[model samples]
Target chain A: MNDEAACVLFDSGHRACGGCAAAMAARLILDAAGKDTIVVSSTGCMEVFSTPYPETAWGVPWIHSLFENNSAVASGVVASLKKQGRKEKVIALGGDGATFDIGMLCLSGAFERGHDFTYICYDNEAYMNTGIQRSGATPYDASTTTSPAGSCSFGNSRPKKDLPMILAAHGAPYVATASIAYPPDFKKKVEKAVNTPGPCYIQVHAPCCTGWGFEGEKTVAIGKLAIETGLWVNYEMENGVVTKVKKVVRKPVDDYLVGQKRFRHLFKPKRNDAEIAKIQALADRNAVKFGIDITLKK
Target chain B: MAIGTGCTARPGKSRNNKTGSWRVFRPEFINEKCTSCGMCRIICPEGCIGENEEGLPVPDYDYCKGCGLCAEECPSEAIEMKKEEK
Candidate 1:
């Protein structure tokens, strides 16, 4: 075992799939947060893979409670730290299932009380741990095991829940949405969230290969496409004000949808133009809301 | 590895499971064409690529799952994915 190789906070050899975006997100989060951090992970894919039984990939102090109570756990940790006069940074990590569906109450309560901790949700869009179930973060019209698109069904009908905006509504000191494709941006956001004094929220768009039906190597590219198409926006919100946004000359949502198998039904058996247009409209709304469209000077 | 009372395990012990055997295509780091840009080290999902003394990327194959992310994201085209045998 090389000594310097151990320098990486999130060590390899964990059971995360090849080119797993959650794994990459974990590495980047620890890289930004450093060793003097306590990670309270909710029961999710990361918890399942990184710490199965007795093994763990985390190089920092880590803890795992129930799926719906990690934010609550972090709240307790924050309160305990305050009592002990400890300065260690508290980061509560969860997937979209835990963040959007199961743990929303705990998350809201923690932020409402203004706990000095950072809650980072790696949104892979669905529950990839328990066999690709439909999650609240699932994009509009994307197929999953539970919400399979067939002759009658058009997959998950609801658009991704605006989690960052919801967290920002809690008067968080800082809130940001990021993607795994932009590592530097993500690292910077994590650093900012950890260093800030009040409760912070960061929702990272981590593309899952096994769930999304893309090749493992195309994880970063898929994530990039999501942003390039305006389906996923990368922006920072500080005290309910938009401070920064990653603007791009938007591409058609078709370019992003065509790559993933989840959206295969949209293209196959003659193009579902009407349905596709609705998804495109969602992206257009995001562009208009964030004003992320950058007109390239020809 | 003795876990302490009430399921307290050692930090970073996932190293016990060597994931190298899971690779179908192995990435070969080509030092000749390498610019030492360190992009491969930063972008690797496995986090197995470490820098050698000369600042070139060296992959710890014991844990590298050969996702070819480094090869795909390499700006200098220094890393190549070769078919693995046995």
Candidate 2:
């Protein structure tokens, strides 16, 4: 493998469809973490794509457990390492399906217990691995297999569950949301979390090419647009207070919705601007609630 | 890859043509029936399919995961899928 290829976490022999953004996210993350990291991946795309019996692509100490217990297992690793006086960093990565929906309980328990690990949620907004099913992190008015948008209902009517808020409620030392589009910011967050004292949670926005119905190369662009439009906010809470904001002023969320097929249902003729507006309002609420420090472009 | 945005975002990852879990299948474009409409390239979810120097749609099989999405979404039935042995 060339030096450039060394950054990838998932390699050949895994079963990810063409244009898998989660795979890209996994690679970007591993690149940021460098080599001194042991990843505990929940039952999701990263685990499915990196480890398939005799043929494995993961270049680090990786473990694949049940869908909801990655955090618990990570806690175990942290405890064992602490007992052994090992200083290496441990990261637990999970998908939105695992993190926001099924694994939420275990994650909460891990955080509340103050495990010395960093839990990064590669949030693609749905269960992309299981045929594009809707998960708790899916945005409102976005169509999925479960939440079909039609004349009556636009899409997922219920807003995405506030995951970072929930993690913050656990009183964890650090809680932040990031996107793969912003590499510098993402890398910085990972470095910060690794160096920080207690448990840290970073929810990184990962766009799904097939599931979201966008061009594969636009994965990074779409992910960046998510944060730029405030559809997804990047912020961190330090010691229970929302102290640092990643991006201040957000673009209109429509730029993001138009790029994906999942939200295509809203672009019809007799359109539901109210639903779109409601989604924007939710983003605005996040800005206000989190007190984002918008940075003005010079 | 052309960088269209701020500061020319540096490219990441290896374009190493390693055939592992994912491999891109080359699209056999029938120039006779091809209307040059660009649907195959447009609908390519991977965006790895694009016009060559001759303006003919070509698939970058190195990154293509053989998803056959091009053949599935082809409008004119001009693109045929051929699976290559890894």
Candidate 3:
């Protein structure tokens, strides 16, 4: 391995699709967290792609548990490390399904206990590992396999669960949102999360080419659009206070929604202004909630 | 499958799988066009990009999956995607 490759903790191989943002997120997270860290990955695309039993990509110590028990497993790891007096960082990685839905109970319990660990949720917005099933973190009006838009229907009827706020409500010292579009910012947040001495949570918006239905190459662009359109806000909360947020001039939500095939139904046959307006309203609400809009003076 | 020490395997053993065969479009690094911004290196999903001397980016095609991310996200348009002959 070259010096550069030696520095990359998450080595290439295994099997993530071309242009997978989750894969990029995994690499960046490991890069920021460093080698003195143990990652507990829940069952998801990341877990499936990065580790295939005998062959694994991770250069650091890594483990995989059940789908909904990521935090529970991480809590156990943290306890064992403390008992041994070993100082290795523990990071629990989960997809949206594992973090936002099925594993919420375990995650809640872990946070309440205040384990000295960091939990990173690669929020691809759906269960990409299991054929694009709708998840709790699925944004409002996205066409998932379970929530396909059809006659008398607009995509997913519910909005994305405010997971960072929910975790922050548990009195976590640090909770933040991130995206693959901004690599340095995401890496900085990861570093912050690992250094913080509580159950810090960071939900990174990883655009899925297969699920979200965009060209593989456009993954980073799509992530950038999500932030610029105010659908996904990158903000940090420390002790339940908004410490920092990535502000944008703000583009119409349509620019972000128009490209993804999941939102194709919104444009075809006729432009569903009403549905698009509702989606736009959701972005507006996020902009207000996070104060992400930048007012250009003069 | 011989499982050792709680079914342990060598770290970074996934490197055995050459993923370059998956590429339909290959990125040709244009030295003249490249300003060595290193955007392709940081943004590569596979982490297959390496830095040569003088800080130029050289992608290890053995694992480059032809995601076109480097070309698409290139600030100076230094990397161009060409149809893979092989």
For residues A156-223, what per-residue lDDT tens digits would candidate 1 score against the true structure?
98888988999999999999999999988999999999999999999999999999998888899999
**Per-candidate interface C-alpha RMSD?**
2.9, 11.3, 2.4
**Model 3 misplacement above 4 A:** A1-7, B1-12
| TM-score (all chains, Cα) for each model | 0.96, 0.76, 0.96
* Winning candidate number (DockQ): 3
Which digits, one per residue and each the tens of the lDDT, describe model 2 over residues A22-126? 665666566567777889999877776666554566767877878889899999999999999998799999999999989888998999899999999988888
The sequence of per-residue lDDT tens digits that candidate 3 reaches over residues A1-298 is 1236433588888699999999899888888888899999999999999887778888888889898899999999999999999999999999999999999999999999999999999999999989999999998889999999999778899998888999999999999999999999999999999999989999999999999999899999999999999999999999999999999999999999999999999999989999999999999998998898899999
How many pairs collide in each candidate, listed in order?
A: 0, 5, 0
Q: What is the CAPRI rating of model 2's predicted complex?
A: incorrect
TM-score attained by model 1 = 0.96
Model 2: TM-score, first chain: 0.92
Residue B61 in model 3: lDDT: 93
